[model samples]
Target: MLNQIEAFQPLNGASRERYVEDLIFRFEANDTTSTEKKRAILMILCGPYAYVMIRSLLTYRPLNEVTFKEIASKIKEHLNPAT
Candidate 1:
């Protein structure tokens, strides 16, 4: 799992550490049966870094122009890209 994250690299130090910690905690818990719940947990765990990244992406855009579906799609693409 670390390998999966390391592939992305260049993350801010504090953010990266928090991400790693959260990843481990989630992996260990492994209790969620719903994909949506699991994904939400992961995103919440990402915290400020994920918040900042998504906010920047939606900058100058109205709330109606932004959607969790779009954010989820981007997250899925980034975290589980096809090789």
Candidate 2:
């Protein structure tokens, strides 16, 4: 998962929105269970944000603490506001 993130271009603004959408679609198409999808979405985040999330994950644990789905939804809200 980390390798996949490394291979993709880092994004901001509109591109980030598209990237997140694509990731969600991919996860859905893969028939990944909800839990796996959430974790994968969180792992896909790059840069300083990713570091912060990782630190939190380590401290709180991925499954029992904050979920990847919640994080992804927050990101979508911030990055893809309605016109």
lDDT of 1: 0.51
- Number of the top-ranking candidate, with lDDT as the measure: 2
- Model 1: CA > 4 A from native: 1-46, 56-64
Q: Write the per-residue lDDT of candidate 2 for residues 38-77, one digit (tens) a residue.
A: 5755464555665464455456555446566666665566
- Tens digit per residue, CA lDDT, model 1, 29-78: 66545555544555554556576665565578753455445655555455
Evaluated with TM-score, which candidate comes out highest?
A: 2
Error of 2 at 77 (Å): 2.8
What TM-score, over all chains together, does every model reach? 0.35, 0.52
